[model samples]
Target: MQSCELSVIKYILFTFNLVFAISGIGLIVAGALVLSDVGEFDHFMEGRILAPPVVLIVAGCIVFLVASLGCYGAIRESYYMLMAFALCLLIILIIELAVGIAAAVYKNDFQMTMKDLMKSSMQRFENSKGDRTAWNNIQTKLKCCGVEGPTDWPENTRPVTCCHATREGSPPPEAHHCRSAAPQDGILYMDGCFYQLQEKAESASKILIGVGIGIAFVEVIGIILACWLASAIKNKGD
Candidate 1:
């Protein structure tokens, strides 16, 4: 390749690395926020749900480090460093591709698994303080009452968090007002937490998968540029 061509590739690789480094830092922050927000309930999170954020954090760190390698290699025109950077990109690309495929394939099953987990968690709500707090948080956030529905709660009693009216308005006329003493008219959110939780998880999973695929594509380009530049440098030396 001509000197001008190599210069263009070098700049392009540097630009790509800069963007990826920024993205890696963003991902690390996002993952940390998520882990922090989970708070005391992190212990309750199923392995599948908990794994993603942790993976994001780890991946972010790796990406940040690899990006540095790429940036330095491109700027310094170091053939060995460029080859190492390309190898790292290839490895990251493969791992991300595999994770994306697995997430896509198991998306539906993940929902069902979450539903079952919620039901099980609800069973322990009365006995476990952590579980109770987690359930309350979920109900409040999702505007839902129980795992199955309002009926899942003890008769004539419901959490105050579940009393708020949805955007559609107050409960139907036949439904009991939350403050009322009538057992016949139950005052609780009519919806179940399961569906809301499932939907949220699915949406998040889709976003993650999309981002992973996009990053993988970028990694491929980075790998190619690094390897080509390394080859060009080696040939020029000969």
Candidate 2:
């Protein structure tokens, strides 16, 4: 390549590398959060929203390496480098398309989940078949563990009869909180957390996608402009 051509390639490759590197980092960070208890990941993990941990790591690796290749390609003045960068971008684009389609397939699930969430929220207080004292007692008793449970007791929490019938003389197992179906309640809680996490993941995915698409489009447009400019320069030189 001529001097001006080399400079243009350098610039293009640099920009490509920077863009993809950010994309890779964002994906990896999002993935890591999925495995973490740091936020509302339970929402994402519940009801089949869980993304395999390995998949995120692998996606991160692919993005990082592909971006690095572009960076290295520019400095080395190797056409092979540019080809590798192109291939990597293509792979990311394909992966994004696949994942996006998968997300759409799960739309019914998401809708149902949202409905459940809202219904649960409103009905928690409305379903008191008996005096609310039992709920307070259970909350009081549970506080021994130095933690608070969900404020709005779900419907599955045992009815007042269950709590009222329990004799003070015979303590039930630790698993049986007064009027509470802890296991089923746990699943409900997990579902809520999983839902929230999916939202975050989907949002992050969109951002990465938008950035990747913008960069790739620029590269394509740059290629065309470069070619036309070089042709016109050549004619002028003649």
Candidate 3:
């Protein structure tokens, strides 16, 4: 309510404003890349419209705009502005939460397609007509995730980083290596299993969002609260 606290709020709000803006810009760029369908699915532009990359960018834009409002409201000290920002943020947050829940629960095609990518790539190596060199080449591009046991090959990138290839020929033994996040985006696993079963990445991500969305939501709420309290303080001072 005091000028001093208001000043502090303004400073914090500005910091958040910058973060939101940068994040929004990055997501939007990445989303456009997905929508463009540059890699394997170019013809299926319509199908890619709401994929994670696009969806994330859209959400980022919304949050960025909302955080911008909070900054503006704090700088201008306008209750109307704060209220409007809070309402918009509430609506978007609800929508995002609903979509995220649906995606997590449904086991959509994205999951299957990504899984198939790994399966098909490995198949190429398996069915390579006994050409030792060709199999080695295929193995080069192939990525093995968490392995059941120590990969017969020596370690390349050790302990919680990206992936590596197999030695000259034998079945690319199970991985002794591990990863914190899947080398590929939107994919992660634990031990030898994939993330889909446990939703370790998905559910963990959701939990993180669950925690984060609230804190940001509260910050917006706090700005509104401060504005209201400021108004009351002003009136009382009069």
Against the true structure, whose lDDT is highest?
A: 1
Q: How do all the candidates rank in terms of lDDT, highest first?
A: 1, 2, 3
- TM-score for all predictions? 0.80, 0.49, 0.46
The 10-residue segment with the lowest total lDDT in model 3: 144-153
User: Where in model 1 is the C-alpha error above 4 Å?
Assistant: 30-44, 154-160, 165-186
- What value of lDDT does candidate 3 attain over all alpha carbons? 0.47
TM-score of 3: 0.46
Root-mean-square deviation per candidate: 4.1, 11.0, 11.2
Misplaced by over 4 Å in model 2 are: 34-48, 52-57, 110-238
Give stretches of model 3 more than 4 Å off. 29-39, 42-50, 108-238
How far residue 57's Cα lies from its native spot in candidate 2, in Å, is 4.5
Task: Give me the displacement of residue 185 in model 1, in angstroms.
Answer: 4.0
The model with the greater TM-score, 2 or 3, is 2
Q: What lDDT score goes with residue 209 in model 3? A: 51
Instruction: Assess candidate 2 and give its TM-score to the true structure.
Output: 0.49
